[model samples]
Target: MRKIYVIGIGAGDPDHLTLQAAKAIGRTDVFFLLDKGETKQSLVDLRERMIRGYSTPRRRIVEGRDPDRDRAPADYTGTIADWRTRRSQVIEDLIAEHLKDEETGSFLVWGDPSLYDSTIAILDEILGRGAITFEYEVIPGVSSVSALAAKHRIGLNRVGQPFQVTTGRRLAEGWPEGADDVVVMLDAQQAFTGHPDAEIYWGAYLGTEDELLASGRVADVADEILSTRAEARERHGWIMDTYLLRRHASD
Candidate 1:
């Protein structure tokens, strides 16, 4: 059976990579990368740097073109399902052609694979078909949620309180009942705009040289975040951001 390591490479900072993740990377004979496109080439470059810096000198890097996802699909769930199916097929072909029996291959996932990432789910689907036989392990690393808290110097949850992690779309529907603390990701609309009084700790392009941070009552710095995010996206051709929101905190 072929061995595969689904390693979490951290949010953005090279320093965020865990020793375990580095070790896993070093063991890989081939590192599989899903090319998102030229717009996000910086991401591709960073991954390349990490592999060069940490992995064995002779390791091979395989690049597969990512299947495009519809950003504004009218049927969101169905569209995502189709995209994932396409992605899984691409990955299946990549593995079958590029890797040999007893050789190790790896996927360097952004942030912890357990959080928000679809790589693991897609891999599971591929395995369920039983067309490929491989042993796999997941290596955990620092997530953007943790990075957001560290950059802000704030705890995710208040004492005796719980925080919910959600996406911008779900948040737009409504805040979770009785949830006072929230961490929002993949938010393109500045979802916190409606709650102007809420305290927001936001970070964009986190851990990279172009990293941006903003915090204050949402009303005061909401525009800053939006403008900064827009400008960064325009400048870099891409951006990844996360924010923590506290509706009402005890002083």
Candidate 2:
């Protein structure tokens, strides 16, 4: 039987790849890549750099065109479900044809695999279809949330207080109940702007040279974050940002 590695390669930093992740890379026989087009060339470059640095010399690389989906779909959940199924099929074909018995293949994920990433779920879906057979493992890496907290020199939660990690969609709906500190990810809508009184620590393009960071009460810095985010998105053609929102910073 073949094996698969869902290795967390960290958030755009070579150093962020843990030693264990390096070992996993060395053991991989094939690397499955999804080409998201030229707009995401930087991500492709990062993965290429890592494969060259840590992978075995004889390792093979394969690319598949990533399926496109509506970025602003009205039926968000249903759209994502369809997209994931399509993506799973792409990966399943790669594994079946390229990965041979007793060999290893890998998917280098950004941030920790257990975070908001879908690689694990996609693999599970592929297996559930019973078309492929491969034992798999996950190697954790530094998550952007942890990097954001570290960059801002603050802990995620106040002592003994609880915090929740949620998406911009949920945050836009309303601040979660029973959690004072909310870490928001995938906020294409700038939901953080709604909580004007909250203290916010924000970071964009984390773990890379073009990284940006800002912190202040939302009332004081919302415009700054909005402009900065817009400019960066325009410049890079993409952006991945996360923030920690505190209901009471003085506490």
Count of clashing residue pairs in every prediction: 0, 0
> How displaced is residue 245 in candidate 2, in Å?
0.5
Question: Distance (Å) between predicted and true CA of 184, model 1?
Answer: 0.1
lDDT of 1 by residue, 7-89 (tens): 99888999999999999988999999999989998888988999999889779999999999889889999999999999999
Best by lDDT: 2
- Candidate 1 weakest lDDT stretch, 10 residues: 242-251
lDDT of 2 by residue, 1-251 (tens): 89999999888779999999999999999999999999889999999899999998999999999999999999999999999999999999999999999999999999999999889999999989997789999999999998999899999988999999999999999989889899999999999999999999999989999999999999999999999999999998999999999996444
lDDT value, candidate 2, whole model:
0.94
Deviation from native of the Cα of residue 24 in model 2, angstroms: 0.3
Candidate 1, lDDT over the whole model = 0.90
